[model samples]
Target: MKLVAKREGLLMMGFKGFTHFILVTDSQEAMMMLKSEMDWRSNVGNFVEDVRLLIIERTVTDVVFQPRSGNGIAHTLAQFGLMEGTHFFWEDVAPPWL
Candidate 1:
């Protein structure tokens, strides 16, 4: 959604010198929603070119695929977001399995 994008953009701006930001997604719909908004010559061009631009700017952000089991933390974060979506800043809250 636009809200997630805005939050990501803001987070990217706030970070001191993070070289990369990865967005892990399990759902096709969520991936499509994100891919659609990525800037490219065409509306739907797989977003590689746009991603390359970000890398050139010294910030490498990309959407990555992960199996449901492998993406537990992201899933948990989304669930937490649903309950407390307005919290923009997160601290070091380790997961149970950690």
Candidate 2:
């Protein structure tokens, strides 16, 4: 489910003319997986491969990791979205308040 959401996010980024991406994750294992060679024999492998393609095609630049301890703005934005029951997809521009 996370991978699927990631793909969808890349799609939006691509649509927004984003040429670089800095990926964030909360797990060392996931960070390692993103850095390692992709596999072709499993569903997870396929998802990884797909993301790689998206990265290259969309000109995504890098993937980075942060420990779960960070009180980042992403967490706050996500919390606001959930509390407000607001699901938004920016097509032409990001919300002004953002």
Winning candidate number (lDDT): 2
TM-score of each: 0.48, 0.66
lDDT per residue as tens, model 2, 47-94: 777777787888767777786678465555555666777555756775
User: lDDT of model 2 at residue 43?
Assistant: 84
Off by over 4 Å in 2: 71-73, 76-87, 90-98
How well is each residue in 1-98 modelled by candidate 1, as lDDT tens digits? 42353345435644656555665567565456455545545543334444334444644476555676887766676667567765443556664544
Superposition error at 37 for model 2 (Å):
1.1
Alpha carbon lDDT of each predicted model: 0.53, 0.68
The whole-model C-alpha lDDT of candidate 1 against the native structure comes to 0.53
Error of 2 at 87 (Å): 5.9
